[model samples]
Target: MSAIEALYIFDEHNATILEHVYRGRPPTASVLLPLYLSHPSPQPSLIYLPNTHPPTLVYSIIQDRLLFLSPSSAESEPLLALEFLHRVADALEDFLGSPLLASKIESSYDVVAQLLSEMCDGGLVSNTEPNALRDVVEAPNWVKGLLGGVGLPSSSPSLNPSSQTPFSLPRPSLPRAPSAATANPVPWRRANVRHTSNELYVDIVETLSITLAPSGRPLSALAFGTVAFTAKVSGVPDLILQLNAPGGILNTISLPVFHPCVRLGRWKEKPGELSFVPPDGRFVLAGYEADLLGDDHLASFTSTSSTSKSLASLNLPATPAVSVSLGPTGADFEVRLSISPRFQNKPSASTASSSSRGGLGSRSASAFSATGTTAHPHIEEVKVHIPLPAAVRTIADLRTSRGDAQYAPGDTGIEWRVAAKDVAALLASHHGGSVSASATLRGSVVGEEEEDEETAPSVSLEAGSRWEYDEDEGGGYQTSSSVEPAQQRNGNGKGEAEAEQRSKRRVALNRVLMPSSATVSFSVKGWLASGIKVDALMVDAKRSKGLGAGVTPYKGVKYLTVSRKGVEARC
Candidate 1:
C-alpha cells in the first residue's frame, strides 16, 4: 500500500518549522527547498524530484503562510497524499483555533505530537475526521496553563489529558473514559453521545458557473451543489431526506457522490431519497452536478413560437447582461451591466395549484404538519470586471448608478462592486416586484489623436449640406465656397496617416479597448436556481440502531447559491 514517508512544514521564509519522519529516509527540507525555489512560482500540487536517489514525489499545499510538503518514495495516489496534508492542516486549526498561527504550534507541542500520532498509524492514514479526533485528542487551553504555573489545577480537565502539556496546571487524577473507537463500532461517531436539546440542521448550497452569448442564448450553464448536515441528536439516528425538482430527479441531477455513512441501495431505489446514519456534528452528506442549460427547456413541448422561447428564457438562472457602446468619437466608450433577480415573486406550479384550492397550508394540511414558506435566493456581492486594451492610455469619467467603481491610471481593467443589500432594498421599494438594477461605466480612451481625421470626410459632408440649405433659403450664412473648402482641405491633409490610424483604431477597439467578455461574481442565500426543494426529513424508527424510544429532534433547513467568478457574458 502507498504510505507517507515524511511530512515537513516550512514557514514563509523557507525555514523548516516542523518535520516528522514516518518511514523511509526522505530528503531534508534544505535539499527540497532549493529545488522547489528553482522552479517558477505557484508550483503544481504534485512535483517529481527525479534528481533524488529514488525519484520522490513531493505533494505540497500552502495554507496560512505555511508550506506543507509530503514526500513519498514509492508509487502513491496523488490525491491521497494531498488530502492527507489537508487533513493535517484542518486538525491543527481545529485544536489551536482558526488561522493556525506559528505561535500556537510552538506553544502546544505536546498536543501536536498526540494529534500527529493519532491521525497517522505507521505511515498509513487513520483518524483524520475532526469530530472523531476531538473525542480522543484533548486540546490545550491557555486558562489551564496559567493555573499550572502557580501549582494549582483547574476545575475541568483538558479533552486529551493523557498527554503532558507545557505550563498546564496540576490536576487530581480522575478515571479516564473508555476510548470511543472501542466503545462504538463506527469510529466516526462517539458512543453514548448525549444532548439536552436535540437539533438537526441541513444547509444546501449551489454554485452557478454560467456563460451567456451576446445574442442572449446560453452557451454554457451549470450548477455545482453540496449538502451539509449537522446532527446533534442524542443517539445514532437513521434519517431519510427527500428532494423534489420540477424536471424529475434523474433527468435533473448527474454525477452524484455521497458520504460513507449514506446507504447506496436506498439512493439507487429512489434517486432523490438519501437514507443514512449521520455522524455527530457537521459533515458533507452528499454532492451533485447539475446541467442548468439542458434542464431549463421542456422536452415534451417543442414549440417554434416566440412566446414559448421567451417563457423558457425566464426560467433560466439570472446572468448579468453586458453591453458596450462607443461614443460619437470612437475614443470614448460606455459599458452597461444589468442584474435581474431570478426568483422574485415567481410562484412554482405546485404553489400556484395549492393556492387556487385555498392557499398552500390548507391544501397540504393533511400531508405535512406545517406548510413552509418559499423564500427566493438572496443574491449579493455583485462584482463585474472589464479589461481594457494596452494601447489605451487613460480611463476617466467613471460613473455608476449603484455601488462604488474604481479604475487607476495604470490598471488594465475596471472593477465595479455592488452590495447585495442594496439590490434587495431596490426590489423591496418596488413592492415585492421583480426589479433590475443596472450599473453604467463610461470612460474616455486616449490613443493617437490623428485617428479622428478618418471621420473628417463625414464631418465635411454635413457642413456642405448645411451650406446648401442656407443658400436655398437665401439666409445670411457662410457660402459653400468658404465652408466646404476648409472642411475638405482639413480632411485631405492626413489621408495616409488617417487611414493607418483608422486601421490601428479598428485593431485597438475590436481587439483591445472593447470588452470581449465580462466576469461576474455574486452569492445568493436561501435559494436554488434549479428550483430543487427538500420535501421532508424522517427518522426510520424500525431500521435505526442504538436509539431510545419517543425521542424527537428539532430540525431546520437552509439553502444558498454562490457564484464566485462563475458567471461570464461576452459583450
Candidate 2:
C-alpha cells in the first residue's frame, strides 16, 4: 500500500490506529484494515494505508520472520509506534522468510535484497522504536529456531534465537499455506498397466476385449449409476473387441454401435477357455477381425512376453480388482482392459500449489489410484472440472461483499495445481517405464468473459513418456465373440466398488487418452464398460503407449472419451 490515509488515537482503547485503502475496483481482490495500531502498545490501532500499486508489506517480529508479500516495499510514511514494531516483525520475516516454505524463498529474498542494496544503495532498517507491538515480537528464544538456523537469522549473529531446535523435517501443519491460495498436494500412485507406450503401438498376442456402459440399459431420469469393470487376466480370452469410431478420434462419442457379443459380470471372472492368441506377437482377442473395421486402424502391434510377475507383488487396490484379465497368450503381449461406466472420485484431486481465493473448500478434495499386471505399456490422462454450485457461489459472493473472501490482483480463487508429470508418472511406474516431458508454466489470471481459446493454452511433455513395453495393438472391432461375452461379469476394467455402497454412486467421468497409439489398448481397472458399442473412430498411433507411430498430444483437446447414454463410442 502507498501510505496511510489517516491515523488517530483510539477513543475507546486510547491507542493508535491505521487504515488502509486497498482494493476499490471490481475484478480485483482487496484487503482493508481500518484499525492498524501505530503504537507499540497492545492498545487498538487507528492508522490507515491506502491504494497504491498492489502494495506488499513484509510483517516481521523483533528478530524473527513472520510473513511475506508479492511486491514487498519499504515504509513511505512515518512509522506509527505500532507500525514500527510491525516493521521489525516484517523485516525479520523478510530476512528469515517466515512460516518457512521451501528454502528457495530465503534465497529469493537474499537476491532481492542484494539487488535493492546494489541498485539503490538503500539503507536496511536496523534498530526499532520502543513499545510497538510489544512482545508481539517473536520470543527471543525462538529467533533462530523459527528459521531452523538458515537464511536471514543464521547470517545475523545478535538477532539469532538462543533456544532453537535441531533442523529436521517439520510436520505439516495448516498454518503454512499462503493466505492467498490453497495448499495441499494429493498423494497418487502411478497407474501401472500393461501398455507402456504413451506414444503409439499396439499388441496382438492377447485378444482385445471391449465393453460399454448403459449396457444397452438406461440411466434413471436422474442419471444412471456409472458401472465400471475392474481387472482381468491377460491372455487369449474367448472374445476380442476393438472400437470402430469414425467421428474422428477427437469426436469418438458422436457415433455409436453395438458390439457383437459381451456381457457383464460382477467379480465373476470365469470363461470356458483361453480363446485367442497374439499371432504376430501382438495383443489380440479371439474371433475378432481387423480388416473389416477398415484400415482406419491407427496402430498395429503384437505381444510375446510372459508374466513372471503377478499383481499381488504391488501394494495397490483390491485383488483381481475387476474380474477380467484371465486368458492365454498366443505369443506374448500385455492385455489392455478397462472398466465400463467408469468410477471416479467425486472431489477429484488437487495439488499443493493452487490459488486459494476462489478455490473449493477442503471438503472438495480427493485422490484415486490403481495398480495392475504391468507398469507401463500404455498411459491415460483424465481431467474433471467441478464448478461451485450456485448456492455456495452465492454464499461466497456475499462473504466477499462483506469484505471476507478475496479475488483479484493479490487475491484469487483457491487453486489446485497438478504438474503434468504427475499424470505421466502415474501411467509410467505401473508399466515399468519412465515419464519424460517439457516443464509447464503456471496458469495466469483471467478476464470474466475470456473465451476457451484464450484461456486454455497448449501444454505437453517435452520428451515422450518412455516404458519397457512389449505389447501391440489390435485391428478392426471384436474378432472372437459371436454369442457376446456375458452379462454382469466380474470387474476387470472396473475395480471393486467401496464395500459399503455398490449402488447409485455419484462420481466424476474418467477420460482415458491412449498414448499416440490407437491400436494398443492398455489395461485399466476402471475406465470403460464391457458392452460399449462404437460406430466409427479414426484411431491413430500418436496416442499409443509404445514409440510406434502417430503419437500426438493436445492441450485442452478431447482426445479419449466414451459416452453411453445415447450411443457408445471411444476416441
Candidate 3:
C-alpha cells in the first residue's frame, strides 16, 4: 500500500506556497498542478493522474482560497490520504488562525514546518488532535503580534501554544519534564493539566439537510450532530454524558462515531452515555447522524398486510419550508419561506406575565435548553438560503415581514436574514409558540415578447384614408375596409406569432424561476436537538490518578444547537 508522498499548498493563482515531502519520491508541483487543473473548472476533490511519468493519486481541499493538495504514487487508501489532507488544513487553521491567507503562511513557515512534522511522520499519519498537538508544540512569538493586531488578549490561555501544533521557534534552555504520552499513555490529552476556574462546556451543533416536494412532502432528510467540549477543569477527571431523544436512542441515532478518549464499553452498555477522561481545552467529543424521518414516518409509507403504497407524505420536522410559485403575469416568481424554531418552551407562572409582554405572544422564542433545564437559549444567525435558476434577470417587489434580503442578476438565489431578537419575538407571536420568521422574494424573469406586447397595446394607430375602419356585423369596429386581404392575413399572422412568443416566454420563465430547495442556518446556545444533558462530571477518586487529595474543582456545563448549511427544504 502507498502512503502520502508529499503535501503542497498553493495560492489562488496556483502558486506553490509550501511543499513538504513525507514518504516516497513525489512529483514536483510543476508536474501535478497542470495535471490537476486540466480536469476543468470545479474540479473533484480527489483525482487520479495516470498520464504522469508515474501514476499518482491527488487529494485536494480548498480553504479560504488556499489549496491543500496531497499526492501519492503507489496504491493507497483513498480515504486515508484524503483525511490526512483535511487534518492538515484544520491543523493549519488552528495554528495560523482563520482565513489562512498567503501572507500568514509566508510569515509562519517555521510554525507550519513544525506542525507538519508533528501531524505526519515520514508520510505516515501521526497525532493530528489539536489538543494533543498543543502539549508538544511551542507557540511562536509571531502569534503574539498577530493576536495583538486582532485586538485579542495577549494573555488569553487559549492562544497559548497548547491549543494547536508546536511552532518551530527557538526555546530557552530548561530541564525536560516527562511528556503526556510517557506519563498518561493517552496521546490525545496533556498531563497534569490545571485551570484556576474549572469549567466545562458541551456544545451540540446539528446541521439539517432536507428536501421537500411541491406538496410539502419530504424527499430526504438528514441531521448531522456534533458534541464539542471545552474543558477547563483541573487534574484527570472521569465523566459520563447522558443524552435522550424524542424517541428511543437506537431508533434516532445512526452511524455514531466517538473520540478515541471515550470508553466504548460504557457506550455499549448505554448507547447515549459517554464515559471518558476528556483532553485539555476544546475538542469534538462525538458525532452522529440522525434520520429526521423516524420509524413512524417510514412506517406510514409502507403497508404490512397489502402490497399497496400508503397515500401518505412525510411531514418534515419543524424546519424552514420554502415554496416557489409563478406570479400573476407568469413571467415572474414569488418565493415564500416559513421558519419555525426547533426549540419550544412552556412559560412558567413567574415569567408568564413578562413573557406575554415580551412580544413572545403564543410561541416561545427563547426557552429552556436541550438538557431539560431552565436556562433560556437565544436564537442567533437566522438565515434562509434560496437558490434561483440562471434565467432570473432581476428581482422586483422584494419584501420581508422581518429582516432583510438581497440578490444579484446572476446570483443563485436570494438570502434572507432575521435578527436574533426579532426572530425570538416572531416566534413568540406565532400560534405554535415557536419562533416564526418568514420571507417573500418576488422576481421577474427575462421576457422580451412580453415587453414588446405590453408596448404594442399602448400604441395608437393614425386615422387616415388607408386606415378607414369598418363596423362588424355585431357592431364591433373591424380592420380598415381598404386594407387588402393579403395585408390582413399578414397582420393576423403577426398577431399569432406574438401570442405564441409570449406563451413560450412565459413557459420558459416558469420552468427556470421555480426554486427547488432552500437551506436554513442558525445557532442557539444552551440547547441541543437530542435533549442530551450533562448530569455531573465527577473526578473518580479510584480511577483518576492525578493531583493531591482533598482537591475539588469548579465544574459547569453548557449546551448549544446550531444549523450551518445543514437544514434544507425543497419544493
Candidate 4:
C-alpha cells in the first residue's frame, strides 16, 4: 500500500495551485482545506481528520509562503510522509531557484509534474536527491529552443554528409546513454565531480542562550552548535573528522544529530569520530547541543560562596551588565560590557609579523588555524539592547565610552553598538597590557509627564477658629487663620516628614522608567564557549575513489559563536 495518497499545494491566498494524486482514494482539496484551516494557527504538521471516508492524516509545511499538504489514509511511517513533503519543497526550490514563487510553479507545471512523478513512484519515494534527479529529468534549455525554431536539429549529427549516401534512409534515433549520477550507488552525491581547486572547509557555529539572575548568577546556559562541511574535489571522497573537548566530547555535547551520509556505526563506536561521504557542495554535517553550565559548574553556582568567581571561570569572550540609577530628576541607566583577558591579549609573534608584511603574500600565513591554537580571537559585532517600559516617553542624553548609542522616539528600546576596531583599540590603550577592558553606555530615560490637578481649598474650624489653607503654584501651603495660634501649628517636624514622603514618591516614580532587562548580541570568531575544537580532518584514500594520487586538498576549519540578543540580564 502507498504511504502518501495525494499532494496539494496552496498559494498565500489559500487558493489551490496544484494537486496530484499518487495512489489510493483521498479527500479532495475543497474538503481538506477547510478542515486544515479550521485548526488555530501555528497548526501542527500532522493532523487527523476522522470525518473522511477512510480517515485521513494531513501533514503540512509552509515554505516561501507556499503551503505543501500531504494526506495519507493508510497505516505507514509518519516520518516517511513528512520527510517526503520536505523533499518535494526542496526539489522545487532547487529547480525553480530560491523563494519558490506561485507564478514560477504555474509557468513550469510541466517540469514540476515530472519532478513530482520521478521523486515518488506510486506513493513510495524513488529518487529525491537533486543531483541524481538532474540526470534523469532534462531541464529546459534555451539553446535547444533557438535551434529548433530555425528548422535545425537540436543536436549535431554524428555522421558526416560525405559518408551518407544520397538515397540512404534516415538513421534510427539511438537511445540516450544513462548518466553516471543515475548509475552510481551513492544516492546523495553526483558522480564524476571535478573541480579546478580542491578545498575542504569545516565551519562550527554555536549560538548562546544564557539567562542570568539580577545577582549575576547564571540560571541557565545552552549552546546550539552546527557543523557545516564543504567539499570541492574531483570524484568521490570519503572523509573522517575527529572532534575533542576539554571535558570529554561525549559529556560536552548532548542530543547530537548527523546527516544521512554520516556513518552511525562509526560514531556509535567512537563518540567524537565522524565518517561520511560528503555531498558535492556545502551541507550541514552534524548538530548538537551543549550545556555551558555542567555539573561541576552548576555545583559551584549553587554554593553561595564566590558566585562571581565561578562565572569568571566560564571564560566568556564578553559579558554584559545593566544598572539603573534613580534620582529626583529622572532615571539614568548604564550598560557595561567587559571583554575577557583572553581576547584582549596581543597576537602571537607569528601572526603579528605576518600582518606587518601586508600583502597577498601573507594570506596563507594569516589564515586562522583550524584548532585556533595560535590565532588571537577577537570580539566583533557587539550590540546591547535595553528594552524599556511603555511608560518611558523617550531616551535622552545618550552617551557611550567607546561606541554609539541610538534611540528613536517611538522605539521601545535603545541600541548601543561597538565595532571590533574600537574594542581592539580599547584593549590596546590599557596602561598595562594583558588586562580585560570594558565599555560603558549611559542614557537617561524621560517618562511621560503627568499633569497636576488643582483641588478645592480646605476650611477647618478648630476651637472656634476658622482656618483656610490653599496650595500655591510653588507647591507650598498658604494659610489664612482667624486666630494667630493656629498659624504656629505648622512646625519643623511636620515639614521634614512631608519632605521625606515627597522624596520617596519621586524614587517610586523613577522606578517605573527603569528597564527590566538588557540583552547582548555579538559574534566571536576563533573561539567557542563550549571549548570544542576540531582535532583532525583526514581523507581516507583506501576507501575513496576518483581522487588523484598525492593530491592534498586544502583543509580549513573556523569556529564562531553568535548571540542574537540571546544573553539576557534581568533587573
Candidate 5:
C-alpha cells in the first residue's frame, strides 16, 4: 500500500507551522525534524531514519521558502509520496494564492485541513486536482468578507438576529441534485465553466546553444523549445493542433515531453499533431530538443566548406563571425563582427521566404495577420562578451566603430552592446546591398610590468676580491673590475640586444591579454531556429459542450528565439 504516514511543514526559520497524520502510527514532527536536519545542506528529497521507533523514510521538498516533509514507516512507492507533496503545495497555492506564506496557512487552517483530507484518503492518493477540489471545498470566509466589503453579494447565507428559533435547533433542508464534484466526468476540469472572452494563444520559444571552431566550423548546435498554451473559453473544448517542421518533426525533434491533458496516442501515430482538452489557464503544453547540425547538414558543410551556407540552412537570422587580430605593436588587438546578410534584408511572407526564414520552415507572417495575430518577429538585445585573461591589469584606449563598449580595470571581460535601433540604422545604410554589415572594436592591452632581474647589481666572487665605495661619484659599493665591463657593455652591441629582449617580453605579455573566445546574445521574434511552426488549431465541436453556435474564438501564435551567451566562437 502506498501510504504517507504524516506531513510536516516548516517555515524559513525551521519552525513547525503545520502537522497532519494520515495513517498508522509513525514518528512525530519532533522526532523527524532533527534527523532530517542532521544531513548536510542541499539535502536530498528522500532520507532514511533508522533511529526512529519504526524507522521511517522521509520525503521533503522546499517551495516558496516553505519546507514540506513526509515520513512513512511502511514500505511504499517513493515517487508517490514525493508527487503527493508537490500536489499539496500546488493545491494550496491554487486555493490561497501564490507565495504560500506561513501566515496564510496559519489563518486558513480550516481550508488547509479539508484540502489535506480530501487529497489523501487513508494515506492513499485520492482527488488532488485543484479544479475538482474547488467543487468539494467551500471558499474561505475571508474571501466572502472581502466581497461583502466591496458591496457585492456573498454566496453564503447570512443569519437574522430577530429569529424565534432556538440556537441549537436544526434548520429544515431541501433536496438537491448531485453536486458537480460527483457529476462531472473529467477530473482535471471544473464543471459549468464560463468566460466572457473566447481566445486561445500558442506561444513557441526556442533557445539556441551553438559553438563554432576558430576555422568557422560548427562544433555543436542545439535548440531547446517549449510550447505554452492559454485557453479561455465558455465551455469544455477539445483542440487539435498541427505542427509542421522542415524535414518532418519525427526525424528532427528528440526527447519530447507533453502535458498530461494531451492525447499521447495521437502524437505517437502522427508526430507534431497534438490532441487535447486544455487546462483553463496558461500552462506549458510541451517541450522538445532539436539538433541544428544533423548528419545530413554536416555532410553538406563538408562538401561546400562554407560555414555561412550551413548556418543559412538552419535559417539563422543573425550569424556572428568573430575574428581577433594582433596589431604590429603587439600591445593592441582588434575584434571584428560580421552580421549575416539575411538580417539586412526584410523578411517577406512568401512561401520561399518562409522556407528560408531561419529553421527548416515556418508559416508566413501574412497568414498570422489574416488570423488576427499580432507581434511580428524582430531582433533585439544584441550583445557580445569577450573574456580577457586575469593577468591583464586594464584595457586602455578602448574604441568601437558602432554602439558602446565597457570595461573595468580589474574586470575579466568586455561587453559590447549594439542597440536594435543602431542595428536597423546599420542595415539601412547597407540597403539593397549583398555585402554583410560589420562592426569593429579595438583596445590596447595593459599588463603588469615585470621586474628585470638582469638589471640588479652583480658581484664577482674571487679569492681576494674586495668591494670599494665611490665617494666622488656618490655611487654605492662595487667591485673594481665590474664597473669597467658595465661601461663597455652599454657602449657596444649588448644594449641593442637587451632592447630586443625587452620588446619580445612585451609581445608575450600582450598575447596573454588577448581574448580566447567571444559569445553573442540576442532574441529574435517571429522565427524559430528549428523551423517549427503551427499549421492550424481547430476546436472539435462534436466532443465539446456548452460552446455556442457560430462562435469563432480568437487564435494567435507567436514564435521567438533567444540566445543568452549561447553562441560562442573560439579564437
Candidate 6:
C-alpha cells in the first residue's frame, strides 16, 4: 500500500493505546457496572473512561528524522481514529523531511493542507466532495491565482507549503537555425501560455518554422502577414517571435495589436493569411514546431539534468515592494544582505528649468518644483531573507588527526539533532563512559570587511575571536553585503565554483550552552582544499528572554577572526 496506509496503521496503534488507557475497568460487565443499578449514581462504574483525559504526549522524536503524531485521542472508535491518522500521514510524506514513526506530536497548518489535498484525490470523495476544496482559499490572492474561474471537481493538489519555492535551472539556448529534417519527424509541442484574466496569451508557433536547403543555405522563414492580436493592455510590448533552431535563435520582432480603446475604424488585416480562433477567448498569431526524428541527418537529441544558478531568484524584486529580511534576526545561520540601492542626495535641475520657464515670476518656488522630489518615498529598503536553516550553524575548534600528523581543525556538521537523553545514551553506548548535555544558546565568530563583500573573514590564532554585539532590549540591528565582480565577469559557464570572490566569509564558533562552563572551538589553517573562506563576521547575541534579539553595532568595526587560538576583533 501507499505511505499513507502505513501511517494509518501507526494511528490505529496510538488509538488502541488510548482505548486501553481510557478504559480503566475490567472487561467483565461486573467490573464495569455500578453496585446498585436500580438507582444509578452519577459516577457509575459502567463507563470505561468517563473521567480520564485522552493521551497527551502525541509525538515521538528521532535524530534528524521525521516524527509521527496524532491530532486527537478522543476517538470513540479507536480503530477508526488510527486509520484516519495513518491515511493523513502517508499522503503528506513528500513535504515532511523526516521519517514519521520515530517522532511524534506534530502541529502545523501546512500538514492540514496536504491531508485535505490527499483526501480529495483518495477515496475520501464521498466524505469530502471536490467542491469542498474551494474552502481551502482563506485568502483572495491565493484563490484567484490558483482556482481562477475553473472549479476543481474533487482531486485536489497537495500544496507542498514549504514547496513555496519555484526554482529555475539554466540550460543551453536552442540553436537559431534548426538542423535538416530526418526520415520520421518527432513531435513538436508548445508550452502552455498562461495569461491573466483580461490579458491574452497567444502561442505564436510554426510561424517561423524553417528547414534549410540541402546545401545548408537559408531556405525560407515562415512569415505571417498582419495578425490582429486583440490585446488587453495598451502599451503592449512588441510581440516577440522567438525560434530555437539548428544554428541560432532570433531576437524578438514586433507584432501588430489592436485594443478596444484605439482603432477609430475597421481593423485592417493582410490578405490570404489564416486568422486565429481561440477556444473561448480572442486569438492572435499561430505557430508550430517541425520535428525531424532520428539519424544524424542534422543532429541528435539528448536530455541532461541541470543544477540551478546560485541564488538566481535574487533578481525578481517584489513589485509595489514588500519589506523583507534576508538574514532576519533569530536565524542562527544568517546572511544579512542589504540590496536596496542608495539614492541621490541632491535633486536634479529639472525644477530649476521649470522655475525659469513659468513666466520667471514664480522663479523662487520654481527651483523647488523643478527639483521634482518624489513625495512618496522610493521603494528602496534593506530586505534581509535567510533561506538556509539553523541546522547549518557552524561549531568551532573540532580538530582531528589522521595518523602521525598533527591534529587540524574543521567546522562541525551535524548529521541531525538528538534529544538530550538520546545523545547521552548514544555516547554511553559507544564507550565506558556517559555524558549529559542540554539544548544550547550558541554564537559563532564570522569575519567581515570594511563593507560586507566577497572577502572571507580573517582569523588570528593568537588573539581570542570576539566580535561581540550586545545590545539592550528593543535595540536596533545591523546587516552587511558586498559586490564581487570577478565571478560575474566570467559567467560564461566556467570557474563558477572556483571564481575569485572578494566577499568571502568564514565563521568559526564555539557554541557553549547556557548552562555549560566548558570551552568549545573549531579552526582550520587554510581553506585551499575546501573553498571555504569567511569574508564577514559578526557576533549577534542578546537576552534570549523576552520579545526578540537586541543588536549592538560598532560603526567602524568590520570583521571578526576566530580560530582555536581564540576569537579576535578586527577594526
Count of clashes in candidate 2: 195
Each model's TM-score, in the order given?
Answer: 0.77, 0.16, 0.75, 0.77, 0.73, 0.16
Ranking by lDDT: 4, 5, 1, 3, 6, 2
Runs in model 2 deviating more than 4 A are 1-140, 146-383, 386-571
| Candidate 6 lDDT, 321-427, residue by residue in tens | 11111122211221111111111112334423332111111113332222222221111121111121233333333221110111112323222122223322333
lDDT of 4 at 37: 97
Candidate 1 on 1-571: residue-level lDDT in tens? 8798888888878788888888879998888878777778889999988998888889999999989998888999898999999999988987777888777887888878878888898899988977567666655876357535644332223343465578887776543545545456666775556666677777788888877667655566788999999898877888888987888978878999998888899899988999998888788999998887565445423655454354264343345555554654455566565566454333334432432211112223232222323444445567878777676556657777777788887788888887655555544554433445455666666544434544555433443444433656676444345445667778677676776776666645543555667777776554686767787888889876656788777676666777777877786
For residues 319-340, could you state the per-residue lDDT of candidate 5 as single tens digits? 5554443666477777776665
Question: Which structure is stronger by TM-score: 1 or 5?
Answer: 1
Q: Residue-wise lDDT of candidate 2 within 39-82, one digit each (tens)?
A: 25532322223454545332322222222111123454334434
Clash counts for all predictions: 3, 195, 14, 0, 3, 73
Sequence-dependent TM-score of model 5: 0.73
- Candidate 1 Cα RMSD after full superposition onto the native fold (Å): 9.6
Instruction: For candidate 1, list the clashing residue pairs, or say none.
Output: 138-159, 138-160, 148-169
lDDT of 1 at 555: 72
For model 2, state the Cα shift of residue 212 in Å: 26
Model 5 residue 19 lDDT score: 93
Model 6 clashing-pair count: 73
